[model samples]
Target: MIKSLSVDETDTNNIEADVIVLGRSLPGVVVAHRLRQKFGDTMDIKLLDLSGVVDNYSSRNVTFQVPLGEDDRQRESLDAADVYIGNVAHRYIMHYMTEFNIPIPETLFRTEVSDPPQKMYQYRDGRVVTSPNDYHEFSFLNFFQRLELNNYQSSLDRRMSELFRGRREDDADSRTLRYYDRTSMESDLVSFLLLSESRDVMRLVVRTVCGASAHSVSLLFYLHQCYRNGGSRNYVGGANTSLREKLLGYCRKRLTRKLQQSVEDITFLVKPIKTIRTYSDEQVIVETTKGDYNYVCNQLAMAVRPEELSKISFEERLLSNLWEAVESARGLRPRQTKKFQVKYAEKFWRQRGFSGEILSVRGPILWAIEKPVYSTTGSLEKYSTLVGFLEADDEDEANSREAVLAQLVELFGAQAASPTEYRETEVEGFVPRCEDYVALRSLARTSSALVVWGALDLFADGDLAAALEAGHSAYVRLVLSMRPQAQDFDDLSAMQWRRVLPDTSFVTWFNTLSYNDGFRYVMYCGALYLGYRVFRKYIIRS
Candidate 1:
């Protein structure tokens, strides 16, 4: 029951909805997915998007695929690595998979990149931090494990818990939050992580995850994001596009599944939403980019970042706080990110006795991992892929792949200088990456009918799990606000909305975070940029 906009449907102004959700982000999909399960065909839900589900991150590197025999469709399934954002192990995705009875593949980690515990390095100020055994190296995980920076880790966890927990907090948590909110992540790192080595490591993690350099981000705000994704341990997004693709595949199936009947009850509008205005009867009108359609609905849930929201117009102007939120979100935008994959003759790093994961303070590329090859057959795949994230500011810079290869020389020696085959893909930063997060916090005005909801950053930061919580929360708020008085839906039990698999177990409990510290790893995010320059440039020039 999916319909595309047709000529007859253009500018109809008759499109109706019990619920209208904007943005095709993971949160929006989850929100609609939840509604489909709860109300089934009974409730009319319309989801509109200016982009694809999960936004830019989904399509950036997906253009090409690995080859096998003669078929390009012979996809290679890679082992889990840290490519996804937040909790790869306990994916909220499991909910849809289980509900649909989709089989879950056991995660196989091909950690051995070489025999002698593969070598890893930290390049800073023309120096390398490594073991006396030239080949002995560590993943970002192992480097911190050796340092044991427990105190700093504990402090960060405490700050996050005080700020981002969903339930009501005591005065101590409130005071803790106020004290930390005033400082930036760089300031806190300098004060808490004493060793220059520790700071160097800490800098990378802060930059990559937070999207800007540590100095630019508020410590309070960053911690709130960490908390939303279920504390520090949950940050794992595995290789390729497995996680997102799976989620989307299942969601689409659920959307198209027949319940009651209509020719194409679920409509997926591919174009961007141009303007959103309100009319006399609390009706929200959504105009599409091509003017091919107009959607009229009573409620709106913007499951997008704050900046994305400003793209649309509202009947009444946004108040200062609301406007300020959008501006602040613009400041937190993700930096231009590029990931590269190189095919090697064999698992060279594993032979050297190391897991091919590298986190750097200085990089043409920040993080590197030995991602497993996508193999259709259950046979030993000899061809290996080395995937890494690079700091590409613009088209010219991103196209200069040679700069990254030079860095690899320093990391793995001359043998690493060249791969049998090398290719790189750039991922555009999500335009609304952190927009909804900023707006929700700064919003001071409220409307009875037209509203936006979802996890911009629930508890101050948003990620996959928080996205689910945000979607569910938005649904709850909609039901509450749309039907203020006791209504037919009031009697609906909360049990119906419960996900088949709740993420509570994998999420680190607030009361439980102990402040143990360790070595730092990950990134040193570059300056913020609107999109991946190389992709746009290539498209334009082509």
Candidate 2:
């Protein structure tokens, strides 16, 4: 007989759920949603978040751009690979939905693509392999000129697309198709090159996408398996909401209904969780802020970083290897990121016949997204705003903003850069620093518990997507291990864990000196993919 678990009386038992999600971030939300989709009303789920309110910035602030290089061949390769991966990922998620008898809107399957621009670059092999949309075909052929290279690229794309494509014919409205057209070429080029060089490249690419460092992660961590297997068309308003606002809205609609009314403190005992106590082969007692809570599961899936996990209390002495791995995991010092939104009374840039997306490549204000958001009242009377982000490292916040504004004015002239209202958001935590990042990865292995032993595998080095994927994978593995079926022990475990390994082959080839341009392109793609994956996974889980 299946028995239900209960929390302390002080914790409101008013809400009953099968899962108690601890955090309300993106991962939490994603997991919650997925579970709901899988079990519907049968699964009682609740969420407990720190702030009691979901921050929408996580979703609305995102800028989705299919990075295109100046080379045609490189662009084709990247575009093709992106499409292949996206479709495969989407398909895998859809399979889960079908297996679990979930009901979702049919519209979720509809994906859309924007028109291809005239001038574009495909960067590969550290050079501009092709330029202009007109030369895309020629560049693809030229870059893959070698008989073996061409065959490999073609085969990889075909196999990936075949495995994931739900729709028989490629349709214009498919976002997956559009992404493929834009990024597959570069991805294939990078994949092929990495497979040829050190296997570490593929591992790096995969880990980078998942949000881990190459040195500690396995080479098979694929983000495609962690994605929601489908796409949606952008609303007519043009995805105008801020990232934070979008995520918060989703939380309000789905998560708020499942939370307990009290706040619980989180504290560590004995520095780290060493031995987890099991009683009568039924319940596992864990130390928490309120006291010891009994959990009936054989494994615990934590969504926190390895460094954070080290702070939890364990009942028994953990294996030396797991302890060392956890101890070795690096802590990330928060970095400061600032965003400035300048609103103007009129369309000054448009009046000057300029497209709002302009780049002052050499200036502190690198680029600007014109008219990023729309007024809530549905009137165009509101002023158009220019949103600019500045990368400030160890600099005074006020000074950095001033310098960026001043530089913008110099590039666009006083009239164009002038704004009637200015708003800025300063983000302090996990600043993106390349040097410090490399150092952290080198130290992240500090645990020996099979679960904690893979602490290094859990170190994302700031790749949010990989972190989210790892969390989900961990959760799934934990759950399956507790209730193992006859057929569940085969290749499933390998496939699941392999998804956490960094694809070293891909990383080495993409980072090769000859493919510097492709390397940068791949990095950007990996970062964005990680962010999206993390947000989706965490939000639902929470």
Candidate 3:
């Protein structure tokens, strides 16, 4: 049932398989692994990727770091609940680590930043800037006045305040997904942020937050990004690469039945699948672009985007909702995120008594962090380093070396301008793969092997938790479909919308704050901490 296809092997080109999972996304990998876990070697499975790569950024070499911070009150509140309140994003990842018996690597503090944020310099038309150490008039109130010349900031100022000031019931309108879906993020930002000094300062904020220009994203999608990341001030270790390596590795190891095994084993093909067709008998045909072979299967699990899904010519049109999803999908090509990582033999910035974190509205970098390669020590680690990120427009390496050095000289002193070694990459955008979501119900049961709904879940904020849920749901549906005679099956997606994990500090802090506190991440974070101390222990506990 599971046969590799080649031009020479005409007999096996149309061999029938039980299931074919497409794309190597985490969801697809999980589907492949779980189906193998459930079905064993009794069924034929073929995992595929059209890109001929396992990961989107597989070719790019970049070190990952998870940010670490918690709203103080949220941590305490979560602690009192006496349940697992670990990072929801990486929660399933940890589960897979345990299930697969693989160690999740803790990334080192590879970079360091010696300065605290809010030392940020904001510039406008004519490179108008106040020194990092001196933005004396830079409170939330006057910031709009300073940035607004043609009423750009003025337009968005009030709306920005209103967006955050609403109560919980107000945000409960995500049903059509259209409440946040209909408008572009640019139109949303138009009320307040302007491209001051050739830089869309507001655009940089959106890019830093959502990973795309406002024009490319939806307003509600932007809000969810803030809501999901827990208001942006939270932190974690970093994107652990070992989680992925182990998960995929384990699936490959377990799914590949040995040559001695009597049952037909799962097989994988690296070729890009170009077409999919289904027969009335519930059998499926998958073909590659190179005319190497055609595959016959009962089902297909897709882990790619909708637009990519459209590329494969299906023998019959899928469900109307699926077609709508394909048409409505935000073909938003994530913008390029440029970063610079500099390594030093000494922790120079830390020696000067700084946190090494930098945030700027000027140029070269939107934000940068200096982390130590060794996690135990912060200011004195041997592998001292600095990593800087370009926000939006100036992401390209245009005279980047000079521009980076100049900014470093201003913040961390002249010594920082030179490093023993440095690396840069246009890291993948942080934006979710899909903005306007295609409802799963609408696309459900469209074809014999059209398990494409799970891939769209990736667009549901790009959070690993979301993808895990989506993939798990697809696996259940696929199981029920293949075994129509089976009387029982569990539906995980049915209850996905009911779970709620709140970060106490953000909710409490957000409620207490004035509506005018917009784009002031530092100010809000400081106030969150202050409120936690007063309200959590002193007043409430008292």
- Compared with the true structure, model 3 gives a TM-score of 0.64
**lDDT by residue for model 3 over 1-542, one digit each (tens)?**
33444556555557566887776555665677777777777877766655543221222222343222311111111111222323333444444444544333233101222343333343532232322241212332244444442233222322333343244423644454554566776665554344333235445556555546667767655554443333322211111222222111221222122210212244344566677766674666777777666777777776665556656665544433365544444343445656677776777766665555554666667655554232222224334767755654534545366677777777667797778886666545424333443233234323334444554424322344445555665777787677655424344423133234333556445443332344476688989999988887877766
* Candidate that would win on lDDT: 1
Ranking under TM-score, best-scoring first? 1, 3, 2
TM-score of each model, paired residue for residue? 0.67, 0.46, 0.64
lDDT of each: 0.50, 0.35, 0.48
Please give, for residues 1-542, the per-residue lDDT of candidate 1 as tens digits: 44465556645546778787776555565566666665777778876655544221232223233321322333334333332323322344444444544333322222332343433556576455543222212233344433434445655665555454434433335445555655677887786656676676667666556435676666766666555445543332222223223221222232223111221245365566677777775677877767856777887777665456556555553222355554554444444555677776767666665566665667766666665433456444434666766655534344646777787777766777768888766444432222233343433123345775443432112123344445555666666676545334533332132112222533444323322321221121222232466667889999
lDDT computed for candidate 2? 0.35
Q: Which stretches of candidate 2 lie over 4 Å from their true place?
A: 1-21, 36-282, 290-299, 305-310, 315-320, 328-330, 360-363, 373-383, 428-475, 483-542
Where in model 3 is the C-alpha error above 4 Å?
Answer: 1-4, 7-12, 53-87, 102-176, 189-203, 232-267, 290-292, 305-310, 329-334, 372-382, 392-399, 430-435, 438-450, 456-470, 483-542
TM-score of 2: 0.46
On a 0 to 100 scale, what is the lDDT of residue 311 in model 1?
65
